[model samples]
Target: MTTLPVRPVTDVPARPQPAAPRREHRLRSLDGLRLVAALMVAVYHYAGRGGEVARAWGTSPAEQFPTLHSYAAYGCLGVQVFFVISGFVICMSGWGRSLTSFFASRASRLLPAYWAAVVLVTAVFALPVVAYEAVSPSDALLNLTMLQMPLGVDRVLGVCWTLWAEVRFYALFALCVVLPGVNRRRVILFCAGWTLAAALTRSVHEPLLDLVLMPEYAPFFIGGVGLHLLHRDRRDGYGWGIVAVSFLIGQHYAVRDLWNAADPHAFAHRTSGGIVLVVAFAFVAVGAIALGLLNGVNWRWLTTAGALTYPFYLVHEHLGWPAIQLLHRTWGLPSYATLPLTVAAMLILARLVHGWVEKPLTPRLRGVLNKAR
Candidate 1:
């Protein structure tokens, strides 16, 4: 056997090419988890809006099953979860796009669906049901901009308040995109400075300022941006300090709000301290995003649930209230029965809006805007 130069099996370890970085694949679970957050909000609304039947269902629904009530009451905080997710998604989405493209994308997503929902709500107002709220002509005009809050007008739909926050956040983030040297750090600085401004104006309530920065809610958004940085950079320690500070600030305000409002029905922290619920909610969102818990959770219905959330959220409150009132009052259905019926109706209507209105309108709007540009 010609002893070929015995190449040692462990020949000089070839310089390990730096391990190819792990690509951050799309987290489908986040999409699925969105329905989780939306469902929580729905449950919150169902219970909170039960009105007289709330007592019939049980004791103070917030106090009856304290655990269930607490979770449901805190469900309004689901919007915070939505906010953080929005910040992360927006950062990911608007990263390299030009300002016009980013704004066009937002308008295409937001405006048409909102206008359709407004029309649907206006039609519902035409019904004889006038117990919940009177139809205001001004609200109809103000709501068209989705800037009602900042402009000192009531939202046409109660839930559209969240849209106002989202619109301002889009404006804020768009400004960041245009600023040179804007990075996660710049965002944190803006958050801190913004929070400080809110603190300075704590005694004075300025709708425009609050609507613009809403620094009281900054932590949630800041924490969200932090999560995005962690995901994109694949680093744990990146921008965590601001996230921690932001979360703590959020908890402080959450507790204070419950204390000040002291609506026994809405007090989520009555059984559990507000801070604990806040922390748990934060963890649910952070854990979901960080661990990719919902990644590749590819069920068609799950996607449908996620898609339904927007229209359902928009249409559910004003519309479902009427459905629940009709069933509970006319049919004499109990709270337990009407609750499901109302939610079911919302789902059906949301499906119609998503299929006929949003899904169709979005492409046309995008095409029109793109062509105009």
Candidate 2:
């Protein structure tokens, strides 16, 4: 807020200056990284689901091409990256805000885009899959709340599973906001508890805890929060330690995944350490972000890419899988080419939703919500 070079000279008093606009912190590199993460997941779903379908129908070959096999196997790791990012972003968002403000921010950012994505996905997937599976309108509508899993109902779209983890993370973090004396130190302790639970999550059979803790992925969420704290106070080694513990635990999961993978060809390349590479990349990326090495990633293009991420993730597989089957059957296109083409189509659809649906509706929705208060 720079003062005026010269104040107006008058017999009467001058009016007060208006407050400066608040500076919103935007991470550009993370945005770019988001697109990368989304692409990784897309590759995983495209090739991986194809393999699953083939195996289910007993049409899949024992061997696959080098690139597709590796990507299909390891691509699932991208969701862990999303989790880390979600923790960091959620923590960053809660700073210096009241609980109400925090919830409003989260809701405004999520619900509109999510609702639109739900409709888009349902239109693409549910109506088509009814031929094979029993999908009632009640079960499909349950996904609108994003609590289908917790309610013991199946998800309308497969991708909705990860969102259930995110919703639980949000709810847990909200406790920190509303409770007294739950500052950074307590948050760090909470991360430790979550990490420990990852090791011995006895509540797996417990319905609510199963949805809330999601023990296998809790480490990623806790690690992201740890990174947020690390970024907040660089001198805090405790934050670093928590992040390290989470990474080690995540590495363990990756190793387990590699060994248990039904398809041996995903590890054929052998350079990336197979599924371990995604977690490794996440470890490095989050650390780099926390250390502020990626301050330069604040480009507008990166911001745009980041903006495209959520909608793209929500709708990609919903659109891609059916399109993949359709193209293979009707046009006789190869799976590899069909995958990229369908991915491209999904990207276009994402851009449409972002531009025409989300961007236009979000502000109006927020304005309405604000005014109603």
Candidate 3:
């Protein structure tokens, strides 16, 4: 048997499969960041009222308050940060999931709480004590559907305008993800093209389409998506560097033209300023990802606060206004005192609502949704 001397079977150790890149789940830092953004928005609105009071009182004190006014300016930027975060987080959470499941999850998560807030706000507006003029049934229905923005109808829940924008963003993203032949590359290109077109059109003061329909804010979302893609793939460092530079440039321009402007409205003169702010926001989104801040250290308290933020955001504006009015009428608290007090009250109430209402209700609602499905 010319069987070649059977080579001693060499036992080759199977190469250990590379440990699946540690799949990170909880991102405590992002929760903390969300808390910071939410607080900024709350403080902004509170301080904004103070500015109005100062103006009405014809006192230089309001303008000189420095801290309050500074917060107000910075607070406006919070919304931009929110948009970026929304794009990044939502996309990351839902990527690769089926569109149906994604939409169902989103509907379950968002609609119950959102509808509750809307009804509560509307009911308050209907009450004799707080009675503002009732919205027409048509307007109310439109708002409920969250289609008011696309239709160019007036917003029923004033603070909810951003929610409409967010809804649209989600819808577009779902379409991109679910449609046949739509891959990550195509989605990226589509988003980039859409954003560039929107920015270019807006810069020229041409309305190619209504803000709601055209996705004028797509760039911020795309920037977020881009960051996610870059980070997930372990691409070259240049992308991160570019994102950082873009952020700094955007922030510099915002501070110089918008923050430092003697007349806040003057910054609005150069419509390009808004574009710059969007760019800056995108930068922050990428930086958060690259620095791992969003997915890094977990702070339970802040995470809890972040969980309550959406409801707080919705309720605080209306609640603060009334609380301020009550204090002004009864105690005649000075603007400085009243502003901080109103903010504190709103925060307290938000925590209560989150714990007592939203937290409890969310799970039950989700269960119902799952059963229905």
lDDT per prediction? 0.69, 0.72, 0.61
Name the 10 consecutive residues with the lowest summed lDDT in model 3: 266-275
Ranking by lDDT: 2, 1, 3
Give the TM-score (vs. native) of candidate 3.
0.74
- Candidate 3, 335: how far from true, in Å? 3.0
lDDT of 3 by residue, 1-373 (tens): 5767564557657678844323446566666666667777776666543443333224433353555564354565666677667766776767655555566667766765566666666666676775255576677767777777767876556678778778877877777664443355665655555555554664666554545334444545655666665656646354444344335434554455444445664312223465465456546654565456566466577677777777777777765656766675457777778767877787777677677777787777666666664
* lDDT per residue as tens, model 1, 1-373: 6766978879878876744423345566676667777776787776643454353343345543445655566667678778877877776676656666777788898877789898888777676644555458877877888877666786678788788778877888788653343455666666667667766666678766765778767667777777777666545564666567667777777666554344654444343375457545764566567656556566667767877878888888777666766777667886667767888889899899999998989978877776676
lDDT score, candidate 3: 0.61
Please identify which of the two predictions, 2 or 3, would achieve the higher lDDT against the true structure. Answer: 2
| Candidate 1 wrongly placed segments (more than 4 Å) | 1-26, 49-71, 129-134, 178-208, 260-275, 371-373
Clashing pairs for model 2 are 28-297, 29-297
Q: Report the Cα lDDT for residue 194, model 3.
A: 55
Which candidate wins on lDDT? 2
What are the per-residue Cα lDDT tens digits for candidate 2 across 1-373?
Answer: 8977675577558689855533347878888878888998887666654544443223442243445665565677889899988888887777655566666767777877788877766665546442234346788788788778767886666788888778788888887543443367678777877777656665446755655677777878888888888888878889989888888887776566455545554433323366566787897897798789988767688877888888899888656656766666567786667667888888888888899877887777766665554
Off by over 4 Å in 2: 1-24, 50-67, 125-134, 178-182, 197-200, 203-208, 261-273, 367-373
